[model samples]
Target: MRFSILASGSRANCVLVNSGGTYLLVDCGLSQNQIVDHLAELEVKAHDIAGVLISHEHSDHWGCVESFAKIYGLKVYLTFGSAKARDIQIDNVSIIEITPQNKIKIDDIEIFPITVPHDAKQPVQFILSDTKVSLGFLTDTGRITPFILEMYDSLDGLLLEFNYDDQMLQHGKYPNKLKKRISDGYGHLSNRESIEFLRRVNVRELKVLVVGHISDNNNTLSKVTELLCEIGGEFQKIIVQKGKKTGWLCL
Candidate 1:
């Protein structure tokens, strides 16, 4: 399987996973033009995309999904609550409502959607497999759970959320209420929280660790690197890379 983070940040978030000629997009936050450009870079045609899976109703995750799927003639899979909350009904697009923990198959790829704690209606992340290798993707989550650890424990690759730095968020010019919301359990995960989650998970078979959904205003690459290094031996074991700017990764 080949995985690529077309973009991951507060501005927009999208991921592409390809397996056995089946291409799936986890989100369509980017504009149609931007998504097309990124797909071009990957040598994938927009019409060739098998499906678009949404994580939540947030604009940075599914804002352009309706238009993108309509234009490309692609199916979109998202929770029913997300679709209703976001008013995601559009002509010429196939909207398939999926439930959390339900497994769906698109061609040769198997998709497992797991529930997540986010300030959205029925948010979820994906675990994909082509029978040969498995890849787990989690982002925009606030707090980590034991169920998350169990689901992502032994994946070949992981795209996990590392949204903010605690210090920066606390000291930055943002309002106190906003800061609290971000640090709250239903907000975003801090760098420390991400590292703690990683340490608690079984990383024996985890090869690639790609940090995603980074907050440009409240986090820095240096801080994320420093926090990861603090994990001691576990930090040096996996091939870690930050998403968005790192382009594509294959395993």
Candidate 2:
């Protein structure tokens, strides 16, 4: 299995995962044109994507979901709450309402949706596995939960959120209310929180660690890098930048 971070950060977020040549998109936050350009860069055809998994109804995550799905004739898998929140009822696109209990199979990959705590209604992250390897996609979550630790313990690759730096967020110029919203239990995970979660996870079998959803205003790459240095290991580490496409990493 292989995956790429097409875009990440507050502005937008998207991920492309491929298992045995079967392509799937975790989210479609970018515009249709941007998505096409990025896929072309990776030599992937947009129409070849099998499905799209929406984490939530937030604009940064679900901005172009409907248009992209309709253009490519792809199936959209999302939670009932997310669907209702967006009022998605497109006739041309197939909307597959999935719960945390559903283990959906699409060609060579099996998808497991796990509920997460976020500001959005019924938000979820995904764990995708083929016969041999598994990849976990987690972001837009407030705090790491016991269920997340249990379910994501054995992933070969993980695309996790490293959204903010506590110090920077505390001292930044943003309004207090917005700051509270971000730092609150249902907002986003800070660098320290991400590090703590990493320490608790089983990293012995982890190969690729892709950390993303960085805050452009409240966080710096150097800060994230310095913190990550403390958790040095043999696993390959990647820091995804905002509005950038990373090269494919295989598991």
Best by lDDT: 2
Tens-place lDDT digits, model 1, residues 108-167: 899999988888888998999998889988887889988888888878888887888888
TM-score of 2: 0.97
Model 2 per-residue lDDT tens digits across residues 1-251? 99988898998988899988799999889999988988998899999999998999999899798888877888999998999899876443499888885799989999999988899988999999999999998889899989999999968999989999998999999999989999897899999999999999999889999999999999999999998899997899999878767978999
TM-score of every prediction relative to native: 0.92, 0.97
* lDDT value, candidate 1, whole model: 0.82
Off by over 4 Å in 2: 90-93
How accurate locally, in lDDT, is each candidate? Answer: 0.82, 0.90
Query: 247 in model 1: Cα distance from truth in Å?
Result: 3.8
